[model samples]
Target: MKTRKKANFFPRFHKLFAVKKIFSLLFAGGAAGAVNGLFGGGGGMIALPALERAGYPVRAAHATALAVVLPASLVSAAVYFFGGVPLAVLLPVSLGVTAGGLLGAALLPRLREGLLSVLFSLLMFAAGIRMLLP
Candidate 1:
């Protein structure tokens, strides 16, 4: 009979901070930040998959991607503000995004993993198509 080794949470967690892992994470984060800064959004298009590839579970990946992008988004918004992008133009979309974020958070836990994965893939596909079209 083959025996499976028990997973140790601390060791697994500690391994996440190893030098190579840290370098990979930094590279991914830099790419996401650059994309966000250049495009005004879409950091998650890079971040979520990066996090997943780094061994985060789907839910954790999504949550961590949000955390990773928030500061980049904030900095980009600040730059836009300095560049005189009008607040009036942003207010409505910001409000909608805030509401949608709240709703999505409330629903995330109840969503099936398969459904979430499919939806995420569809979103990425749509974004890629849109980018390629114009």
Candidate 2:
């Protein structure tokens, strides 16, 4: 059996630090964490940009977002598990999404650069329109 090597910095945060910065990290982590748990997809999208604006390096921001997401994902999964959600329905969708996400990630590097921007903008516009609908 081939042992897979541990990948480094798939998500990492290496930055300068201070006492006050701990609070910032905690706050960023918590806010992003909750968004991830509550809404699912928008947390990373919002967190990365917001963290960049707040002076974190892009890589660090992503790492922070991932850090937050890890716990939230676990908790959400736990809640679903304990809440008597039918595993039959959840299992197929979870597997489908996991497989689809893997394929998307693999194909990501080969895709057009502006595609994400256009898609995100459209989603935001659609959401705004949805909000305005009577």
Candidate 3:
């Protein structure tokens, strides 16, 4: 039986363009953080692709993105809360969102990578179209 080897927590680079890789990583990280802070979510959308490009498997990338998004989300929520964004809306939405998040997290591991990619692409495309509409 063939065994799968675990990926390193930090990926190791071979004799490649190290400087460019570092710069790309820096840019991606900055963009993810900025998007999460400004939009109050979506770091994961930016982060998923960046992690995939950095050689993480799809499942790992998605999980890592949730880890990345969590703190950014908290900080943004705090800012909005203090800035007087209506807290009332949060109560209703948070319940559904929490349940949905749990369901999605539970389903992630069971999904095939190809199906997951297609679903994510469709979601991004739909979001883009929604933004372009009136």
Candidate 4:
């Protein structure tokens, strides 16, 4: 049986950029990062495609994007806590998200590439329609 090789995370981070891909990466990352920073979700929804276009493997791009977002989440959580968001409400949601994230990490490599983009786009479309409906 052939064994799958593990990717070096930092090298993969560097690989996301090539001379020709600089603009694409900047635009994608800027757009995704801004929305994610503002809304607290949807960055990954944007990052995956940009990273893919820039030539990173979907799995690696997703992982790297998640890593990039981790600090953002932490800061957001801190702000919510300080702003008097209830711990009781926050705890369960946080736990569920963390558990689901762990599960997703374990299973991500097993999923077919490009599926996430389709799912994410559909989700955004649904969200948009829902907002419009009300």
Clashes of each: 0, 0, 0, 0
Q: Estimate each model's TM-score.
A: 0.68, 0.65, 0.68, 0.63
Clashing pairs in 3: none
Residues 30-129 of candidate 1: C-alpha lDDT, one tens digit per residue: 9999999999888988999888988889889999999999999999988888988667878998899999999998997898979888999999999899
Error of model 2, residue 7, in angstroms:
37
Q: What are the lDDT scores of the predictions, listed in order? A: 0.85, 0.70, 0.80, 0.74
TM-score of candidate 1 relative to the true fold? 0.68
**Residue-level lDDT tens digits of model 3 in 1-134:** 12212223223542254556668877887899899888777888898898899887978988998888888788887887898856588778989999999999899789897988899899999989999999
RMSD of each: 6.8, 11.9, 8.6, 10.3
Once fitted onto the true fold, the runs of candidate 2 whose alpha carbons sit more than 4 angstroms away are 1-15, 50-64, 127-134
Clashing pairs in 2: none
How far does residue 15 in candidate 2 sit from its true spot (Å)?
9.3
Best by lDDT: 1
| Prediction 2 global C-alpha lDDT | 0.70
Question: How many steric clashes does model 3 contain?
Answer: 0
Q: Candidate 1 vs candidate 3: which has greater lDDT?
A: 1
Among all windows of ten consecutive residues in candidate 4, which has the lowest summed lDDT? 1-10
Q: Per the 3 Å backbone cut-off, how many clashing residue pairs does candidate 2 have? A: 0
State the lDDT of candidate 2 residue by residue for 53-95, as single tens digits. 6687867987976665677778776766686887789899989
Tens digits of per-residue lDDT for model 4, 14-119? 4555434877777777787677768877777787777777677867987987876677667665765576877799899989999999999799789975998699
